[model samples]
Target: MLGPETLSTPPQSPLVPVLPAYIPPDVDMDVVLAEVAADGVSAAPADESGLQRVVADAQQQGIDLKVVVIDTNPPIDTPLRDIATVVAQSHPDATVLVLSPSFAGTHSQVFDRVTLEAGEDLAKTGNPVQSAQNFVDQLNTPDFPWTGLTIVLTVGVLLAAVLTRMLQVRAKSADAPKPQADTASADS
Candidate 1:
């Protein structure tokens, strides 16, 4: 029941549950930024030199990638994505990847939201370096045109149905017997 007056620091939002957006209090923004500024990858959660190597290679390839691996979530129920967003505010132009124990989150200026979400899906290996490797690998994979393939398949099925219907009609008409008119009546 701490009121605003009683709070020594800025109050956290129950809904957003994040810091005031300038910087998140639970996370050491200075350390994250400093590590990223040094070699494009943070030092925590990924002490393995392989993640740093992967990030360095990505940077060399013009990816402008920065990775942050948080060993734990914030003090509140903050999403890893929110942390990534906070990092993004500091560097809007660089792609930031933030990994947690069970989830991945990212924010990027060089990539679209779809790609970022896809990267997050690929980056949930629970190992920071593996997550980063999977994300980078996904970038090189070409997109298959599922929409176009679906359209083609639909049209083919419709065409086949129409051809079958037309052939059935033709066969029925050919098998139909011609009427022998009034000749029998005249003979009678």
Candidate 2:
């Protein structure tokens, strides 16, 4: 019978640079961080139960887990990719995942490249906190990011066109002169 100590382990290799870095092969998670941390690693809020559990699990397995909680409001100039790059620089051999929360919803990255959003079950539940928590719970799962952004953008464009047409019609109607009553005919 296999036990924890008797479990088979994979051979370790020197970390190498990978391209199109979406979801690199499995390695023990060593660091977690937000995009803005000057150093890829830092203390984050204990409220994130999923992250906390990951840290604890790593410790139990004797793997060094570094946690970096990203800033709630990241700078407009700093994108997710940039943050991941920064984290990678700090820990070249380390695997980086970004867990971001927002009022709209929550999402995470795997392999530091592939974007995976939380399932819709939480969002439809109408609880922001719970929805965000649901997002955290599904962070490590093999899911794809929602493509609703494209649809949303398309809707926005269509709406703008409709509004512009309505304004043009209104302007033409307002500019036209009102028909005057024939006072002379009435007097005759």
Clashing pairs in 2: 23-111, 30-66, 32-68, 33-68, 34-70
lDDT of 1 by residue, 103-165 (tens): 787888778787777877899887888888888877656677889999999999999999999
How far residue 98's Cα lies from its native spot in candidate 1, in Å, is 0.4
How high is the lDDT of residue 1 in model 1?
94
| Cα RMSD of predicted structure 1 | 7.2
Pick out the ten consecutive residues of candidate 2 with the lowest summed lDDT.
Answer: 103-112
- Which residue pairs clash within candidate 1? none
Model 1, residue 88: displacement in angstroms? 2.2
Q: How many backbone clashes can be found in candidate 1?
A: 0
Residue lDDT tens for model 2, 1-188: 96667667886656533443423332112444332233323434443554556545544644333334444533331343444455656555444334334322212232332332233233223333344335334444655445777888889999999999999999999999999999999899
lDDT of 2: 0.44
Off by over 4 Å in 2: 1-41, 45-50, 58-66, 75-78, 99-112, 115-188
